[model samples]
Target: METSQITDLKRILANSLEGIEDPIERSRSDFCFYLENVVHDEGPHALTDYIQLADFHREIADTLMDDKTSFLLVEAFRGSGKSSLASVAWPAYLASLNPSLRFALISKTDDQAITQLTGIEAILRSAEHQRIFGDLVPHRQYYNFRAPWSEQEKVIVRPKFSRFPTFLAAGVESSLVVGKRFDCLVADDVIDLTSSFSPTTRNRIKHWFYQVLLPTRDQRWSKVVVIGTPWVADDLYDSIAKEMAGKSFFKHIRIPAIQTEQTDHGPIYKSAWPEVFPLTNLNRIKSEGHFAFQNQYMLERYDVTQSILKKEWLKLIQQDYIPKELTILQGIDPNAGRVTGKTGDMLALATVGIDADRQAYLLDLVYIKGDIQEQLLHITDHITRWNPKDIASEIEATQAHFKNYLEAKLKETLGLDITIRGITSKNVPKPIRLRAMFDAFIAGKVLVAAHVNWETGDLEPLPSLLPFVEEWISYSANAPHDDALDAVDIALSSVLEYGGRLAALTIPSEAIIIKDRENLEKEEEMSEEDLELADLLEKYEKNMTGTSVLANPSRFFQRRINFRGLNL
Candidate 1:
């Protein structure tokens, strides 16, 4: 604030750097002290109470310097100050210690690497840098003394007094210049979400890392450090982690958002910096959903271990269980978005039966895309075969229109009378509905056959299994083609009526009925047309799980890709 205070602060800073002549030794002795006392305001971090910062990032530096750990992988949360600490300050500090230490810093792109190196070079040129670490110019004339120093973005500070590089920055794909070996490789932001999304790009980047980047390191004594947060479960970091865990050469350090503890003041949860991330903010983050908080802050895979609708959580039934007091229902999510292929919705419907014990089994699934006549034929075939007590369809604007059309078509063509009720909600989102599908599965109330690929009755289930289980295994928030999944969710939600809670625990459950045609006809008073339609369906009910029908979007794309590649 005043001249006197500034002088006193400088005096204190000088005193703090007292016996630390070598920068590497200083960083080793106290990284936080060096950052606060010497290289102030030069790093990316604005706030510098680095007590917890040291807990997370200092181990990375210590491992790189000591040479005990050859590979250091740090999966830090966003806004955790890892960039400033790992890529910028720590490398600069290491350079001052080993002026002959050849350092290579890389990012996702060459421009990014250059920009980060530029910041590091600026830090080295600061007044405090000159005062504590000494000026770039060693002799009388400043320009002449500094003539040997190269300040380009690609490479910074080729030692005038020595023969090693301060740091060489490049993109992952870029080639390292000849005539030198880099002993330290600091890869920052190497694999971001965008770059890691494509399988081709992901493979290319990983191939570069193994084939190209690894060769640039000095074979004698090189140490690598990866600095970034985890995005997906199988990103670059995860791949390295798979190979390097518990090995003698590599080490990993992960810092979570907050830690809950019990004290004299009762149970309390607090982040490393409450000013940066308060409890209320964390609750808001959690409200974004399970995977959002876990992936970003906790460096986890959005509950891949035990997500809602997991395979292990589901109860399976191989044999048919026809019982009384049954609530036979069908959830119809008819193609609201044009059934016109390439950019349209597939008609996804699920026929489920809940018994007296509340153990619901998926009887059949109808997933297809066709014209209005074909759609009516396919849907009516399932209704005739299954004889579900009630049918629930999402009453969105377009779907209501489709439902009206479906009713008119059924009455006209088949002379069959049917009513498909509308299921409505105000502001409920898709993910919420998807999440709500989990409660019943987790409660062990839902069941599926080993083979749900084809639309078949319980008595004569098809063995041509194109397992839907695989879809659940790979599904995440970013997955495509969720038509069949949405239909199943609607069906479960309707019967369970769990109100998004565990239905078995909270509410009295509904029962399912498996009615034959004779009983169904008597109950609903089927006319002559209905009986004719039933006979036609019974005669023609083959396995309708054709590849061209209502399958997942991913399945369709995959089939297309495979078809194009086939030589036969």
Candidate 2:
């Protein structure tokens, strides 16, 4: 703070740069070095002492300095100091290299943008910075309006070759930089929680980003960097990720607070910043609320309230506890196209069994990425092992051929006649059907087999059901993929329907049942009135059979069906 101490600090910084040839150029080329030596707010201790530079920070620095990367999107967890590295230090280093460089810093609000601008101002005016970069802003004219040093904008003491200011800070809502172009643009935390949840706000921010902010790039040597924590799916960050995917000049980096690995014991959680946020500390944060922890720390994108299923609600029973007389049914959701890798779209098959009490147990789940033939082979293998009594499949109008092919394959391979019941999802939305199927789960009527270590009293998810469980817990109406959910929904819904118990719970308003063509031919000859009666009788027979239905005498009368002396 005093002049004498400032002189000593400058002298020490000068002595440190004495041996290096073109130390200023090194500061511009090596971002990490610049961040360490020239950009320090701590008094005596180095920046590393206050904030440890993790490997992801180094990667971010490399990305900022790389010439080939023109667009970089960083989604690091909270407290990662991404703003300091990308917004403050990187801009200061660039301005030190070229005094005429025009840089724009944007945030969610003007106050936040000004706060970040103050950091860059402090670093540029520091003793070490002036000693190396030679007085970027004249000390005497710092407050003078003609020199333009303020919270919103600052022009360095350089030749006025361009019309744009050397540094500008504004919010995403500001129109100050309508026609101005910049050498570097940084959009930081442009979408907060409020904006992330509102579609109109997210759309407005997205439009401003593409229509206004992005056009300010100089297009010759400009670099654009967007950095923030993920708030939700299809937020501005997700939109940017979708836009920049697979592009040569774009790079996206995501670093979560904890990394998980499955071991023989169980899952092990490793902290990304172990020195700062240890596993114990992260777990403590998780205890606060998993939804917040998942969004802010783990970088997952789903709201707990909006999620259709909860992991805690899924009952896990021991494998040997299953009833021997349970009727098993397999449901398959085949991928329309062939895929070879684990990351691609998958063919999902879920096997569910209904016990005498009409409780559904998720027996087995399989997700494979392959052609239809390969998918059929997996289905056959599961059926051979489980020996399910019935098989149901979701057959889109475009994929009707799969039903015939699968039936023929089953007859030929097993030497048995099995008709594949087709489920048509024509007018109904997937979320609606899934919600209807999970009604049983909410009522404590659905269960899953668990892998238990009885000696340790520890339990792990069944290996085959792990993927389905993950999808189930994270499922939202707008989830990108729902193959596993579809398979489970079809299987569970079919089991409930076959047991004549679907009407007891909330039935999917849309009729998803599709009979085979041969069964349809039998009803075509009936008269108009007879056909309506037959249809009702067929639905009643299919949806009403077990003692559970017989116990509910009022339910039969509620449907206005006359069953006076039919079977009772």
Candidate 3:
């Protein structure tokens, strides 16, 4: 643990036990005190030693204990003890405070719900609890008549109270809570991975929550707590957030595992619970997979199963297989402004090449994270290397100025005036354009260079391709960043517009054939301009006879039309 964390723990401990004399009262008042002095079966380590409590845990406990806040939603990271704190410990503490208040513990299934209720049962039946407060369970003589104890429900010894059990365990789809009412309701992990992916299951869970379980709450004085990790967008948690937008009684708290802050130099990342999950441990988890880490730990919800792009659609080939007469183009998707930190939008550039067969290849990709100068230099370097036939950039209100500046920079650096073509996506939706661009992948017309081992002939992905591939496989409509996809789409659209007929195989065979002249006497009476036009037309026909129009067809047409009024 860090020195600051130790200091914060000491201060928390002092405040928790400051003016409290009786142990029972201290445990009842402060939830942190209860976890430290009463609950002893947490794990192999003590609460104050190895598994030190974080401030967010205290915040959650305080919110649960608050009387004004009736509804609380906690979207915490996985493995952050949210279940133990909100569902088990908080309900037990409430029972200790007032033994007659009925509570409901809900999960995705009945078995999982009962498992969580068992934790509270074990705490109530512990000797420490009995020594501190009293016997919460009823005696053998009064078990059958007054209070009944079972796995599904546990009734404490509350004389002259309502017939509802002290704690009731039920699943989201269970009918045990049909007519039963409760003082407190805790929904834990009600939306699992399987339910999150299915719209039917998600709707069912939502219906049960809003229709059945919510009506069971005592309207006079009741509290509801929903605690779970976010699975995907528009799930139950998102529904709750939208429903309770500006309500003062509802409190929503989201705690990510890694917190980032931008400073003067760069970004700094720190763990939310450093004692439990340090920086080193968090980095190790991040290395496993970017999508998993973001979804589970960072609480960035993404449903890749619903994404349009798939991993198996990416085709890898050797670099030597590229045709010699390939035409390359560069695409740019610049950021709105200069990027200063990791959270800022990236400047994405993609170099795509096309062959006579209408196949596309991802030659190279560049991502810049600095200011405009750095981005300009990086783009200039790419232009120098690839010598692309055209450079296409997304030109919006924010990027129009940057485009002008980029053109000037190219003229100053390379001493060559190059005009950049602007591509606007305002009329078309992004997902539709992206689908059209990636359809080449589905058709087995897109290829990437594979990193090959010379001796063993083993093929792997090139280092420059990993980031793009990761984004490709995890592409969703609600993805955080789509700059790379936008860049590639721009480049692909330019290539298709120039040589789309060749790829679609829609050109007429008669367009490429040159018929013999009917009269040679009319050719002798032609002027010099007519003679030049005829010669040029014959040469163009010869070139188009057996070759594909994949080599800058737009430029070829412009040059031919500018020389004279020739239609071929």
Best by TM-score: 3
Global CA lDDT computed for model 1: 0.63
Tens-place lDDT per residue, model 2, 490-513, is 787576457856323211111111
Query: TM-score of the candidate numbered 3?
Result: 0.54
Residues 354-415 of candidate 3 have per-residue lDDT tens digits of 88877677778887677877888889988998999888998876676677778888898889
* CA RMSD (A), model 3: 23.0
The best candidate by lDDT is 3
Write down the TM-score of every candidate. Answer: 0.51, 0.52, 0.54
Off by over 4 Å in 1: 1-29, 41-54, 137-165, 176-180, 260-269, 302-345, 348-481, 484-568
- C-alpha displacement of 182 in model 2, angstroms? 1.0
What lDDT does candidate 2 reach at residue 504? Answer: 32
Q: List, residue by residue over 1-568, the lDDT tens digit for candidate 1.
A: 9999999999999999898677645544665657666554433663452324445555655665666788989887777777777788877777766566777888888788877777677667766556666754334454344334444332333355444456677787776534557888889988866565555677888888877787878888888889888876567888889978989998888877876689998987778556667878776665434444666787774332233345564444433333545677888888866533334567878877777666676667877777766777888888878777777787776788777777777788778788877776454545445654554544445656442222432222323212345445556655556667777777766664522232243121111121232345366565565444444333334334323322232222212222332332
Instruction: Rank the candidate models, highest lDDT first.
Output: 3, 2, 1
In lDDT terms, how accurate is model 3?
0.76
Could you tally the backbone clashes for each prediction?
A: 9, 1, 0
> Cα lDDT of all candidates, in order?
0.63, 0.74, 0.76
